[model samples]
Target chain A: MSRNLLLISTSTTHGTGYLEHAEEEIKSLLEGKKSILFIPYARPGGISHSDYTAKAREAFERWGISVSGVHEYDDPVKAVNEAEAVFIGGGNTFVLLRNLYANKLVEPLRHRVLKGMPYMGTSAGTNVAGRTIGTTNDMPIVHVKTFDALQLVPFNINPHFQDPDPNSTHMGETRDTRIAEFHHHNRQPVIGLREGSMLRVKGDGVKLLGPHTARVFLQGQKPMEFKTTEEIHFLMDAY
Target chain B: MSRNLLLISTSTTHGTGYLEHAEEEIKSLLEGKKSILFIPYARPGGISHSDYTAKAREAFERWGISVSGVHEYDDPVKAVNEAEAVFIGGGNTFVLLRNLYANKLVEPLRHRVLKGMPYMGTSAGTNVAGRTIGTTNDMPIVHVKTFDALQLVPFNINPHFQDPDPNSTHMGETRDTRIAEFHHHNRQPVIGLREGSMLRVKGDGVKLLGPHTARVFLQGQKPMEFKTTEEIHFLMDAY
Candidate 1:
């Protein structure tokens, strides 16, 4: 049986700290599902496996969902095999890519997702769903041993879309400009998800969530903005 | 009919309260050049254009080399054309990129280089030589309203190479892992250049500068280290 996949971006929980509002989002997704298998992948920024597990447990308990950390399960394959849904939390994108490469988990995770397991990823986790985890701003918090990601989605996701800071002194590139550069090099529609917003991928399309707006940036064209109620079918072509 | 270009990447300057060490390197580059044109194209940090111009002027004055600020020239083309050599000083990568985009000077500068004018970049200035300005940790102090960069070099340059900070509590990817991730998606080698070090690109090949070591990271491979004397032909391939 194929399960649904939920991907939550790391920026979504960046405000309330980890596992606070994330619990509410997770519970809503896994309301009736039993044996929810939580995979806190993309643990960049030097976050230990235990810390991610604890965050998931806090959210799972609030929703009355049974949650188990896959990292503690000696056999990750077994843990993933029995789970009805998968949740990927965000942190450092490179660290996540490193762990995924070290464990050779990309293929296995892809296989499970293909079999219809519901998968969820937030922030850095959401980064993995794209063609490559190249757009993440998570500093290389760890030495990246490998760079492999679950290429489920076609384009990159830029989360935490807030207005530019006025007092920041470090000037390298803004998020909008970075995505524009990405478009200049690669012809892909980068999904810019503002805070309190999401792209819910259903059977063959993605539906915007929350009241925030989403911006689709493509090369050689003006950026197109969308509202929460908009249905984005172009995501089907992303893969 | 071509001017010289000088790129300067310092080990440390006085602003960060760090000791200055690249003064000699700057002097050596400007030693024989009498009619020198100083271009402060990469002052992303709070280092004002006048401040950078003044710093270079002081350095050159010590070496008896006449340094003049070309930024005051209303027409950038006229200013660049009249110079015998162009020198780009370092600061913040984001700020540099933003200014470059705002002025739309990337192509004109590249044209100058192709015309056999001497070109040089230091720190963030050196990074502008790459295809994309992605390997910078400089904060986005100013919103440039665009992410355009001077794609002189194909690979991303990670300045200020050091081991992971043990005391940093900030989460997410480390600098190394982030560059590694960039290597995964990008075939071009990501070069980690330590302070006082530089990759001097001549006509056909590139030579390393300074005494520090550089690490070239690629996807699916261990980081390959190099020395100052090594001739990096692969860099041409990146372009």
Candidate 2:
């Protein structure tokens, strides 16, 4: 049975208000699924079990899809194993990585997804699906025991991309400068995702979502911008 | 006639308590100089001109050295040109870099220092002397206009290198893990300096200071640790 996965960059209850479209896309993904489970285990946002469960319930109810909050289950693997599809909400990338490692879910989650289980991740959750967890700029507000992450995607993803903050006083390299520095050493391409956007990967290819632009940075070259509708064929070729 | 240049990482009056030691170091470096002109152009910590001038005056008074604060000079090159040895107080590296670039002081400072003006740097000031400002862990709280550095030292220096925070919940990556990842891509060696420790480069050799340890990391190898008194002969070899 081939299952699908949806990863969202954020799970703000109102959806990405910019396009007023996250809910619609999510509903379309879950429309015909027989079993749906919400895994909020990557609760870096200090989200309690109940809070995450409630958010999942809210989103599911809006779409009229029966959803179960699986975090309450003693064995998350068992819960995930039975689910036809999974949706992960976002908060802090480090928090999510910590939770995933703490729950020993990296391998199991990777296994389920590889076996054709539908998986979805937003924000921090989407960060976990990348090759390395170094792209995140969120503060290490909490310490998780391990630094390993799921290597579903082969490149680093910088979400919530924006220009340099105008009011900051401590002088340091900007995000663009830091990314350029990263490129000086890393050959891997970094994908910068703006707000109200996503990269949908089916099998091995990724497609952009929403109206925002994405930037691809490679070593010794200028960062190239791409539209949301362009096919991310380069990622497959590079990796 | 040689002037004194006292480069400190933090402003002494900022309540960081390193002012006494920094004062002593400066006095030792400028033993025979009777009058010292203080230049506070790298003002990144939101330090007011009067406040910085007063701090320099206090340090000089304690050392029994005559002092003149030159904060009103407006032009860094002009201010630096007349100084015997300039003391650069550190707050943030990026802020310092920005001011240095805006004032066009890199060439003047470099030329003066190379001409046997005893140069001293603490913390962020020391970072500016490095080949590149890539190893700093300071928050990108502000953006500098450029990434250019003074390049007094050939390698990147990680200052205030304490062990990983025990209470931090961020399980993303340890400094070691991040450095390892950095090594995977970057071939340059990173010198980790613990608090109270300093790296002194004279001629072609580098020496460590204070009671802490320095760790040198290179690609494909275990990090090599060194004591404060040890000579970092490898740095000489690199140059």
Candidate 3:
């Protein structure tokens, strides 16, 4: 079975409502699904799980889908097993992966998704679906047992990727600089998803979705800019 | 003896030479010292440890101080114990902490500094000198054994902190937003040191150095803006 996933760069774009920009893709991916198992584990900005889940519910409910948070169930593993679909919202990657490990849901969710469960992720949510959380832009607010994440995708995902601002004088490392640093110890390719872009994967097929172009960084070569119109099926073998 | 440290925000400000902005502080901290042991483990931009050390040597040579990298020593702990002064330059914090632990130098370096040996750090270097590396702004490019650090200071440090750009259309979390998330899980106060800033800790006094104001985030309180002239001695009790 092929994994069905819509990994978004962000839940909301500047001056836009939550998931507003990706509504069309979200609707397309969840077609015919009656409900979604929302994973609010990332808890963007440290909001409570329930509060975070409510945000996801509010968005999905408008699209005519019933949404329940994974936290609502005693057995999170079983929830994934019975869910029609899973949607993990964006937040702190460390917190998201830590809770996944804490709940022992990484393997089970990976298994369920491999069997073709529709999976949706935004930002930090998308970061965890990749080979490892090594390229995340989030602060290490919490420590996880390992940086190794779900092998749902062979390459790592870098959400909210912004190119270096030429006129700016800031001294922090640029997104590209950090990704290059990541290549020093890691050999996996990284998909740098700009604010409005995303990756849609179905079985052996993959497409870069949205209006912006994605930056693909390989270990030994210069990073390539992939347009939404380009074919990235070869990325399936990125491992 | 009290810890003596000059933890700087960044080694190079936008148009300045390496350590140019913090030359006075560097000189004051290492006064009369004949030689310095440098920890170039952070290896900025993925440069080799030796090449990184050469960068430090070139900068300090102008100031008339002899420099050597810890990597050159047979044992890092012994090097830290014997050095007249220690300076850790900036790069990737995880790599720095991982190597510090791998070489078993964290505790020895901590002990040496607590004896009043001058300790200096820039960016990732300043980050690890804090209670933990939990508030770092760098990408989690590697798996560290732990987020715990030297505890040279009672609070965590967020170096190279930039305020939200009012004109930025970027949707990524702002520095303040990330620090707030850090406060949720960590109680220690965080000093959001902007570029060109440095923190000086002497026997019983601490001074915030540089022209820019620093943002201090404490759990449950509105983050306060602190100035270079303000007294932050209270931060020692932050733990």
* TM-scores computed on chain B for all candidates: 0.83, 0.82, 0.98
Cα DockQ of the candidate 2 complex: 0.04
Per-candidate clashes, comma-separated:
52, 25, 0
RMSD of 3: 1.0
The candidate that wins on TM-score is 3
Query: What does candidate 1's lDDT look like per residue over B128-225, in tens digits?
Result: 76666656654333334434356565566777665565754333455677766555445667788776666666665767777777888776688888
- The prediction achieving the highest lDDT against the true structure is 3
Identify the runs in model 2 with alpha carbons over 4 angstroms from their true place: A1-3, A13-20, A144-146, A165-170, B1-239
RMSD of each: 11.2, 14.8, 1.0
Interface RMSD of each: 10.2, 12.4, 0.8
Docking class of 1: incorrect
Q: Candidate 3 clashing pairs?
A: none
Q: What is the C-alpha lDDT of each candidate?
A: 0.64, 0.63, 0.92
Greater-TM-score candidate between 1 and 3: 3
Q: Which 10 successive residues of model 1 chain A have the least lDDT summed?
A: A139-148
Question: What is the descending DockQ order?
Answer: 3, 1, 2
